[model samples]
Target: MNILIVYAHPEPNSLNGFLKDLAVETLSAAGHEVIVSDLYEKNFKAVADRNDFTELNNPEKLNYIQEQYHASKNRTFTSDILEEQDHLLWADIAIFQFPIWWTESPAILKGWFDRVLAYNFAYGPGHYDQGNLRGKKAMLSITHGASSLANYGAYGLKGDLDERLFNIQHEKLFFCGMDVIEPFIFHSSTKEDAKEGLFNDYRKKLLNISNEPVIPFHPLSHYEKGQLKDQYKTSIQQELEMS
Candidate 1:
């Protein structure tokens, strides 16, 4: 499978960098075509603005979303954005390798999503499960500075790690119709001894990408008029109903 690794760490010697390298090496050794987008090295612009388009839909009004949609229709995205989008289109799987900052990906990576995943292409009407990226898969390879226990259940300082990543896994990747794989998190990433184990686990995950269970997401069929079917209300919603 073709794999695109969108790497966002600034330091090449960082743990996130090692994993990114390992992914490219391991996937390539397995005969999969691997492309790495080193955002920092490339000096990728993290801001989405008028510079993203060669021509604007409304030169007077700077509505980014409408401009993106119009540019997509006209094939007027800037070269950098078009190139990244093309890579996304070519890949069967996309891996995001980044260190969590303020409980989210770095601004550059977020901006990459804003610019590269054009409105008409990555999403629009009949989106989510019906999005343009339907058959592709996405995985998050994240490194967290906090310990695993600290990011765990009720007593932990931070809530569930999954909850922290919901915006990226659910809102972004899943919104684009990519089958989301459970994120591989390396907690307490500063520890040196964990490197070998982390590398091994990551290698296994990469090699078994086809077998990895996808995170369950409500399909388009489960929604009627933009709301989930009554039978599909999550447990939280059910609890609220009881209250």
Candidate 2:
């Protein structure tokens, strides 16, 4: 299987970087071809603006979505964005590796989402389970500063980590029609105690990732008027406001 690891973190010596490096070697040893888009090393343009499109449908106004849709049909997206899009299409799965900053992915990853998952290509009205990237798989590999306190649910100092990741997992990954697997995270990855055990776990998980199940995101037909039918809500979604 082909895999793409979209990594974000400025420092090569950072925990996020080390994991990304390990992923390349580990996944490759498992017989998977791997590609890494090191955002910082590439100096990837993190901001999405008019520069994204080589030609514009409406030069007078900056209608981002409309431009994206137009670019999708015209192949007018710049080389950088096009490269990332090509990497996505070529890969069987994409793993996003980053630290949870402000309860979300780093700004560069957000930019990657915005620019690569363009309208008419990644998503549209008939998206969700039916989007263009339908058959692919996606997963998150994140680290955070908080310790076990993050797992304390609503009472946790950081709130529920699962809940906090709902937007990224459900809204973004699932929205793109990929079968998103449950995220693999290393809490307090920066701490000395968390390093060895967590790194070993990550290596083991990658070797067996092919057996992982997709997260239970019901298909579009399961929705009515753009809302999930109540019966479709899983205990996790019902107990915690995942949507």
Candidate 3:
């Protein structure tokens, strides 16, 4: 399977980088075509701008945007936006690796999503109503500075790890049509030295996601239909009761 690993750690010497490398090697060894988009290394621009929004009504401008779009799809180097779009199209699975900061992804990574996953490409009108990214799979591989248990929505803590990624995982990935796979999170990434075994175990887990329990797939239309599926309906109700 073709795999695109989008890594978003700033420091090259960080454990996040090491984990990324390990993942690359493992995936490559498994004979899966692996491409790493090292956002920092590539000096990838994360912000979107006016040039990105093509006006379809203006004939001259619409022609220009059409040219740009074709050039992008044809790989004539039309724009970075097209280039990233191409990568997503070529891959079957996409893995995002990053560090948790302020209960979210680092700025650059978030920016990557903001800029790259654009309208009509990732979602919205003229795109696949559901997961224009359909037939693809997505997973998150994140590291956090806090203790693992504390990150849980339960344990008198924040919320479940999955809850934290609801937007990016379900809303974003699923809306775009990618099958949302379970995430592999490592808590206390800052305390790696004291948790060598945990790191190894995490690595082992990362190497085995094909059979792992995936994050529950929640369709955006579910709510429109008035409620979540049976499993999630029960789980959410239970969560509310516990709270």
Candidate 4:
């Protein structure tokens, strides 16, 4: 499988970096092609602006969505954005590896999504199940500075991790038609004592990731006027309850 690892950690020796490297090594050893986009190393631009487009469709007004749609159609996106978009299109599985900051991905990674998931490419009318990334997969490989048992959802101090990631997994990846693989989250990642064991488990997880569980995101058809159909409601509720 073709895998693209979009990594965002400032330090090369950090935990996120180690896991990113491990993923590349493990997947490549397993005969899967892998590519890593070390955002910080690349010095990636973290904010979207008019410069995103090579030539302006309307220079006066900076309507990002409008420009993205036109730029995607005209192939007028700047080189950096275009390059990442190409990688995104080429990948069968896209893994995002980063250390959680303020309950979210670092600014650079978010910028990647902002500029790379161009309109008319990643999302538009007839998106969701029919979106451009319909057959692709997305997985979050994240590290957080909190204890798994204490901060892990299901009535934990931080509520639910699943809920925290709903916008990303559901609104972003799923909305773009990518089936999200269950996230691989490491809690208290700064604990040096747990690093070796966690690394071992992470390597094993990467090797066996294809068999891991995928979150149940009902298809667009399962909704009626933007809500779950009556017949699907019970099952959806049951799944949420079980989670």
True lDDT of residue 239, candidate 1: 56
Error of 3 at 95 (Å): 0.6
| Candidate 2 TM-score, C-alpha based | 0.92
* Model 2 weakest 10-residue run by lDDT: 233-242
**Candidate 4 lDDT:** 0.87
Q: What is the C-alpha RMSD of each candidate to the true structure, in Å?
A: 3.9, 3.3, 5.1, 2.5
Off by over 4 Å in 4: 189-194, 235-243
Write the candidate numbers in order of decreasing lDDT. Answer: 1, 4, 2, 3
Query: C-alpha displacement of 219 in model 4, angstroms?
Result: 0.9
Query: For residues 24-114, what per-residue lDDT tens digits would candidate 2 score against the true structure?
Result: 9999988999999999899988899999999999999999999999999999999999999999999899999999999999899899999
Worst 10 residues of 4 by lDDT: 144-153
**Which wins on lDDT, candidate 2 or candidate 3?**
2
Can you list the residue pairs that collide in candidate 1?
Answer: none
What lDDT tens digits, residue by residue, belong to model 4 across residues 1-243?
999999999999977887898999999999999989889999999999999999988998889999999998999999999999999999999999998788888999999989998789898865788888998999999988875656766988987878878868888888898988989888754477876888898888889877767788888999888898887876654877878
Q: Per-residue lDDT for 124 in model 2?
A: 85
TM-score of 1: 0.92
Residues 1-243 of candidate 3: C-alpha lDDT, one tens digit per residue = 888999998887887898888888888887789999999998777655445544333345444334435433444332666677888999988999998888888888887787677555666543322646787888888887765566565753666766778878876777777776778777754454767776677667656756656555545544545566565665544666778
- Against the reference, the lDDT scores of all candidates come to 0.88, 0.87, 0.71, 0.87
